[model samples]
Target: MTHVMACIDYSQSSLAVCDYAAWAAQKLGAPLTLLHVLDEEKYPAAADLSGNIGLGSREHLLEELATLDAQRARLALEQGQHTLEKARERTVVSGAAFPELKQRHGHLVESLSELEAEIRLLVIGRVGENSNRGAQSLGSQIEAVVRTIHRPILITASSYRRPEKVMVAFDGSPTAYKTVQMFAASQLCEGLPIHLVMVGADLEDNREALEKARSMLISSGFEVHAEIRQGDVEAALHVYQSEHGIDLLVMGAYGHSRIRQFLVGSTTTTMLRTATMPVLLLR
Candidate 1:
């Protein structure tokens, strides 16, 4: 149950996932696993090809189709194994030692659901092999996992480097506090500079909550810099992240502010599209 599970599909996002998962494996003190799922729906081995034949179709053609289906399934299995081995090698080189490899045959969401209990931190790519890029291209499987899975998800972009500074999009809600506490408990970002930015109307209450959150991190041995910004929450964070050299962004999956808008629906995709840095969405 302490696996730093990384979902890889050999997409452009996959290499980044492996690297981030390796970093997580070191910080979390857990084994790294490169998980590849041969989605049957997308790569069917025995799709029903018997009934939809043309009126003058040859029976031998149906036989040939069946043979091709079997070949496709076999090829998918072989490719999955090859990809897993390559990913494992990449992860180990990134920093993790002796990473494990796993291959499952099913839908992505269902496969993850079965492995939910075993995952301490789940690292996944923002887009899959089917999606072109991360901008407004949040894959359906990612959305399902973010919504249904009961764990922290570290969503990786197509490209990422080791993060030097970390930023938490704080709003002073219960989830926001939990996000801080979760970050404190894990050594994932240990010793890195922290920017606790809250975007909203500059009310005294917001200031108070922000200070409280900062104190918690300070007590946990983190260098903390807390502040309140105006304008859109997601937009402000992106600006601050870029200006401050923040390479990682952390936030609660559910919150009261418009920040939550970036976690679900079309808005989420559009907001995260330009965000090339990885986002740690707390459960």
Candidate 2:
């Protein structure tokens, strides 16, 4: 069965992600999997702590380093296990029935890619344990994971409530149209009020697409509205979200071409960072 996979790290936002994942799982009638990945590259076994040590103590230093590495591995295992247990308990308390817990060791994106087939949706925080920047900047793994995994990802904020109103940033891209259809068909956003907003001066061309999408949602029993504005995408969407009281933002993730891989789309990244509420990215 497909499951909603929530990535849990040592970051402060992990609990929020878990709770939101539970809510999503309940809504979709899918199980929730709390996944914790220990990326070995992020944690080194040993650092060069010996500053100008004499040669006589070099053997002892090497032995000590080996022991320290073993100890670090042990601690990491214990911590990951404890974290998973807590997350499972939290998910159960949050109304998820029989949520699964998993801990893996490797690159997070690679691990997630392998599990993509079984994952219906991915829940992750905007920032992670390695993030040194404030909330304005995203975690390093976010881009890679979003690009690598084909599943829809719910980029969670520090907190989440069941969204009453959802806004779709429509740009007439194929991916965007697919996102609209997915939202209409999927149980994730069913019964929510949806707003389809496009930012551009070319309303003549956008009207047909907007109307089609709006019609689709309406047919699916969604309370749908469409609007068009002119300005920068992120700024326009932010204003609309604030003014209209948007509880969730949904959009297609940027494509993963070589150029895009090297230079991530600024609009998506910036909007994801600046969004006050949760953002659902469909790839």
Point to the candidate with the largest TM-score: 1
Expressed as tens digits, the lDDT of each residue in 64-169 for candidate 1 is 8878877888899899899999898898888797988888988888898999988989999888887765443677667778878889999986786898899888
Clashing pairs in 1: 135-273
Native-to-model Cα distance after best TM-score fit, residue 155 in candidate 1, in Å: 0.8
In order, what lDDT does every prediction score?
Answer: 0.83, 0.84
Candidate 1 has its poorest 10 consecutive residues by lDDT at 262-271
Model 1 gets an lDDT of: 0.83
TM-score of each: 0.91, 0.90
In order of listing, the candidates' clash counts read 1, 0
TM-score between model 1 and native:
0.91
Candidate 2 lDDT over residue span 140-213, tens digit each: 88888877888899999877677889999887766677888888889998888898998877657788878888
lDDT of model 2 at position 47: 52
